[model samples]
Target chain A: MTKKQTCIFLIIVAAVIAALITGIVLTDGLYERDATIQETMQDVVLHERDKISLFGLAVNPGLISAFIVTGVILVFAAIVRIFVIPKFKLIPGKFQMLLEQAVGAFGGLARSNSPHKNGFLGAYIFAAGAYIFIGTLFELVGVPAVTAAGECVILPAPLSDINGAITLGCLSYLVILSGGIAANRLRGAGRTLKEFSLPVSMSFRMFGALLSGALVTELVYSYLALSFVLPVIVGVLFTVLHAIIQAYVLTMLTSLFYGEVSEPYVKKPKKQREKKVSSKTEVVQ
Target chain B: MPLQLAAVPLNIDWQQILLHLLNFVILFAGLWLLLYKPVRSFMQKRREHYEKMDADAEKKQAEAEKARAEYEEKLAGAEQEIASQRRAAELQAEEYGARQRREAEELAKSILAEARADAARIRAQAEKDARADVAAIVTDAVEKLALKESASTAYDQFLAAVDAQSAASKKPAKGARTEKDHD
Candidate 1:
């Protein structure tokens, strides 16, 4: 930049910093006088109820965030299908290549995992992976909203909510059970029934992973000493890490279990039971 | 773990769970329709179109190659036929030329033989005529001489000269008499 441009940029940055400091000081004074906030900013961290009143019904913050993320995803998919997908050439453009690679990878993973080869699993996994990744990073956009208590709060990631985690976990388990049943019939139900607590374990794992990031960010923001640069650093790091790790973890677990349950059990006669064991070793190899 | 779960507000909200499930299902359906189906269809069509075009081009190339090979084979056959016909024609022409040459040689030989015979006959006739003219001139000279001198004395002189000349031409007269006898 030229000297004049550099000077102007520094001036604008200084003005923005001054405005932020003034705003924070004013808000601090107002909160000190208000008895409602005198509980020493107890809600700055994890709160019991972050309820949002939508259409005269009490909805959780996680639910609204999910709705928004889903809407964004839908609009994005529509735009790509209309404006981008039609323009796909025999030789792919960057956006077209990115979409193909993403779908191909997820589909390839499912196909490679399932011994019985469920063709639909790939698409389902792609959908699930996309939702998890996007929903985890949804709150990083800092979408501000007003709660029923007239307080300003940014909506957190949808999966950070226990309810969202439970929904995803249950859905994955159902998908696995369906794959097993499709491949093995009644035997598939028996196999799936044996892993009855899978949904609970998966839900807790996801919920805990996402909530840890949120809680850390909140803890950073809650302390006056750490609210400035520290919160920004902690929040971005935690959010990005959780987005990638949680997305991979959920997708991996779902695909693995789906693959396991989808394989048909081979029938061996009594005389060939030991022979089946030898064959099993060869199959494993 | 139980204490941690209790610490967070993880109450089972059926309404929220139901809504979230509905949202995920919609997302899945939307992605499948918008992204997977269209991309797969486009790829399938493109692959089939290219494959069909390649097959057509290959088929045309094979046809053209077959036609060219047939044409080459036919051309080679025609060339071989033409070569054989030319050889036969050349051999016939050579045979005709040799026959004509032989006929010409035989005809030339007969004509030369006839010409030689005619020249010899004409030369003999001229020689005979010259000899007769000389004899007649000689008799006339003798008669004129008798008129100028005594007849008996001139006749005696001519007889004596004839006798002397006869003696000198005896070998030629003998060969002529033999040839006349043979004729």
Candidate 2:
């Protein structure tokens, strides 16, 4: 931008910030009940009022957020599949290049990790990575939904919930176990069985990491004075950081374990075994 | 039974877990069908296309190289043929020149021998004519002495008689040459 344009842009940003502060001050006076630090912290931890009914069953905010993220992904996927994908050229444009890079990254991850059986692994990791990344960022929208207790609450990150995290973690472990079985049969299952605590560890790790961000944002918001500008920075910073970190960590772990279990087994020939035995006997003698 | 942790409220609901699992499975299916599979296949096709183009280009280059080699071989063969033909033509020309020189030498030798024979025949004819003139002069002197003329006058008479006899011998030879032509 030119000097004049930059000055105009800064003026516009200042105006927007002024308008936002005025709006916040005006909105703050209308609250009927004040949210205390203890109650807010308890709500963040226990999700005491973040539940809603879905098909007559009580579901947490994470499930609602999962559906929202799923819907968003599917809709966007449909748009690309219908409109943009057909128009992709050999010399790719920006959007096409971005999509290709994303797909290529995951595909390369699979191929490098599981060279022998990468077709399914590539698809699986791509799905898992997309779900984690998109679901983590879903909370940034802060879409309001009515809780079962008739209180309105903003949807949180899907994996911040214990059950959702466990689901993905166990699913990834199951995928790894299947990979092992497909590659080495009983031996593959035995190998996966050795890492029995993998699912619980993976799930709890994601839940803790994601919850820390939510808890910190809740703590920041619990203070009425600090809730204004601080929550924006702290909330965005924590959410984005958790999103990236969790996505990479889970996918990396999944691919690593999948590749490990899916590795093809090589058996020694009978003659080689006999030769080794003879060699050992000769050394002993 | 769900184990409760101290201080933290934990709800481990199997129903919620199943629901979340179902949701993930559906999302995976949708994304796989819509995004991952098509994009990957398209990329794979593009890779295969470029590979095929590269292979075709290599084949064309190989063919061009083969054709160039054949052309060079033909060019070399043509040069060798021209050289061989030139050598043969030079050998024929040399043989012809040698034959011409030999014929010229033989003709020159025959011409020289013919000239030597013609000189010998002319020399023999001149000697015969000289001998006839001397014999005629001697007879004429004898006739002048028998007639008792003075000695000096007799000598003069022999000279004149010799001149007449020489003239007579030339006329008869001319007459003999004409008679031979008439015959």
Candidate 3:
């Protein structure tokens, strides 16, 4: 930044810190609650009373967050499809380059793994990767919704919930199974069936990784002293890191298994060739 | 038999799982239609267009090379034809020069033989005329001797006749000069 901009930034920071101190002093007992650490922990672990009803059914906060992320993604996709994509030039601009890179990365992944049958596999991985990465980042938005008990709660990352993780993991396995079936028919299905532990492993891995970030962030917020600036670093670091690592891990594993199961079956050589080989040896002798 | 299980930590709701699955499916379909398919098709089309342009350029270059080779081949053939034509003309010119020289030599030999024949005939005619003149002169001298009884006067008349015969022989020399001009 320039000298003037740096001075302005420093002044804004000081003013915001002053305002926070004043607010803390003024609102000291305004929002006080007589809840124990165990109760807070129970609320974090099981949000039974914090569920929001969607279409006459109670859904977790993470589900609402998932819907928000999905809606945003869909709207963004629509905009790109209708307006941005048509303007893409042969010589790409910055936005076009980014879009092409994202699409090409997934395409290259699918092609490298399953060269023979990667059309559907490429599309699946692209969708799955987008969902995981963006869904993880959705938690940072801190959009609050009122629960069934009229208590406002921040919607967490979607994959932090077991339902979302299990759904994605099983879906990935289904894609792999479909790839196998499409390529090698019954034999392909059998190959997928041979690795029955894939869905469970993939689900729990995603759930654990994402939940650890949520839990750590919760733990920081639970303590009043550490809630000031530490949650920012911890929350951002954990969410972003888990997003990248989990997205990569799941997509890579799915493509690998899909490729293995979809490999073309090679037939054995005929008996006539072996006989011809022996006859040639006899002739040589 | 009913078995009562202890507290399970997981809130595994089948409905929520199903809803999440449904949400992902919708997202996948929407993205496929909106983003992935169209973008990939555009790239594939661009690649094909450039490939076609490259092929056309290569084809034109090959045609140009073929045309250049043909032109060079024709030029070489034309050069060989020109050389052969020049050689034929030179050989024809030499033959014409040799034939002209041979004809000139034969004509000169015939002209020399004709001139020799003309000289020989003129000499023979001169010899005959001189013999006749001498005979007449001798007869006249004999008559004078008989008439005047003087030998000296007859001898003077004979000398004059010999001088006339010598002057007449010079006419054949003029005829030989005409023959030299004809040669």
User: Model 1, A1-285: lDDT tens per residue?
Assistant: 999999999999999999998888778755442324423223322344457897986666887898899899999999989999888898888887788788777867787788476577877888888888888888789898777777667988888777888999999999999988998888887898899999999998998888878777765665566778786678777777888888878888888888898887988677788888899999999
lDDT at residue A178 of model 1 (Cα atoms) = 92
* TM-score of decoy 3: 0.73
lDDT of 1 at B115: 67
Q: Number of backbone collisions per candidate, in order?
A: 0, 0, 0
Please provide, for model 3 over A1-285, each residue's C-alpha lDDT reduced to its tens digit, 9 standing for 90 to 100. 899999999999999999998888788677565566666555555555578888877888878888888899999999999999999898889998898888899999999989999999989999999999999988888899988777888989889888899999999999999999999999999999999999999999998888878888877876767877788788887788888988889999999999999999988778878999999999999
DockQ of 2: 0.56
- In terms of DockQ, the best-performing candidate is 2
C-alpha positional error of residue A280 in candidate 2 after TM-score superposition, expressed in Å:
9.9
The list of candidate 1 runs beyond 4 A from truth reads A1-47, A227-233, A269-271, A274-285, B1-9, B49-183
lDDT of 1 at B153: 68
Greater TM-score among 2 and 3 belongs to 2
Native-referenced Cα lDDT, model 2: 0.85
| Residue B61's lDDT in candidate 2 | 100
Superposition error at A252 for model 2 (Å)? 1.1
Judging by DockQ, tell me the better candidate of 2 and 3.
2
RMSD of each: 7.7, 7.4, 7.4
RMSD in Å for model 1: 7.7
Model 3: per-residue Cα lDDT at residue A22: 88
